[model samples]
Target: MTIPQQSGTFVLVISTGGTIACTTDPATGARTPTLSGEDLVRACGTTEEVRVFDAVSLDSSAMTLADVDTLVELAGKALGDANIAGIVITHGTDSMAETALALDLVHDDPRPVVLTGAQLPADHPSADGPANLNRAISLAADPLARGQGVMVTFGGDTFAARALIKRDTAERRAFALTAPLTVPRPAPAARAALAGIDVPILRAWPGADASLVDHVVAAGPDGIVVEALGSGNVSTAMGEALGRALDAGIPVVVSTSVPFGEVSFDYGGAGGGASLGARGALPSGWLRAGQARIALATALATGTDPRLLLGV
Candidate 1:
């Protein structure tokens, strides 16, 4: 699909690398990122004079928070460039939401940043990268997307970055966020050093013990997030260990493993969110474990109260 060009408007295409840019090795059948930013823009078949920049070439699973810093740093340059209307980033879907949220934290500009990618590699017979790339470029070039903060456009749908969730492994329409998630204010920024710190996640399960929690706490991690049971409840053993971690001044956040509900301080026992809340544990309002870990890390990196990061 060819996107109509605006009179003088242009969008910057930033390629990081993912399945959208991958080529399969015939010998080993291993897929690797091989396409550059210009390569992707060239395949769009549009007359629009889109600018391209190659950022990195790694799978999202191997992506680090420090890598997100580089994206923000590059985007910052566009803030002063009047020629660019918006920015579109081609990224791996695995950790796209995490990196999008991280980028949103420091995205002080009004121009929207749109993220998109495909489930199939570029070499596949039914590869969806070309279509997804064109759609992303169209959205980025549109004046309507301005001031909407970070967003993802995939499979013909557009969603605010905060609401994006990748649910299907290989489905063409895996991303499902029908509505925009608005924040009263922009996400607070963090210290440069803290973005690279390590934060681990623990899950609460049937007859779960404190060994994992104890070991993680003993290591003195930067912070921790618990994937609790219903309504954010945990086993007594795990809760006690988490409480100890809190006492040690490590920020602890409780999030439910359930995919559809928000976590709350609804119970009163030692394993309950209420009990944990009383002991300085914070509830991850609507964030699941994945995004919670990223937000918790950002909170620990800054002087702001971590509670503010949970509500998004």
Candidate 2:
């Protein structure tokens, strides 16, 4: 699949280690991120003058919040460079959605930032990295992809960073958007930052108790995200613990564990959504638990009230 490219357009490829850049270790038979950004560009067979920068060389599972901050800084610098037309980031799919959403919130640049990766290692016979890299570069180079905020282009589809989610564990087309990308906005002068803060996610399972919630609250995290049961229902004890966290001024966001549904405050029992809402628990709309956590962290880092962004 070939995408039209403009003459003299230069693309900056930032490589962070993921399966897309991994190779098999002969001794251990384990895959690792050993390929460079230049190698990826070479595999794609692109003729455009590409500048490669190796950001990190580790699987996405090993990625940290600090790594995310570094990637955002690199992308911001690349987008500011006059010689660069756009940027492509090769990332691991494990936390791709979280990283993408983080970048979208902070990177206001209109220039395209395309994130892509593969399920198979680079040295595998059926490695998908080359193809995904090609598609990402094509999207990054295309004028039509500009000003769409940061996007993930995988499996021949493009998703807005804010709405993108990793839906499948081992599927080639792992990402899907909860919503669509809208208008472009100016890149903010200052990007959001995190300090390795603790933000625990507690799921409301059958016969769930408040012990986990109490422990998390005692840890004094910046916020908490609860993957509540259908329609955001929690056990009585869990709801009370969440209420206590909110009362202590720690933001509590309730998200549905269900893949596709909005959390509502309709039920009004001891451990119901409405009860939690009355005690200051906020609804996460349709955001998944991970996305809600990212949003909450970003909001706290930027000194913005999380409730304002969450529409609670």
For model 2, how does the per-residue alpha-carbon lDDT over 32-76 read when each residue is reduced to its tens digit?
888898899899887667778888888887878888888888887
Candidate 1 on 285-307: residue-level lDDT in tens? 76777777877777767666777
Once fitted onto the true fold, the runs of candidate 2 whose alpha carbons sit more than 4 angstroms away are 1-8, 179-190
Tally clashes: model 2: 1
lDDT of 2: 0.80
Note each model's CA RMSD in angstroms. 3.9, 4.2
Top-lDDT candidate index = 2
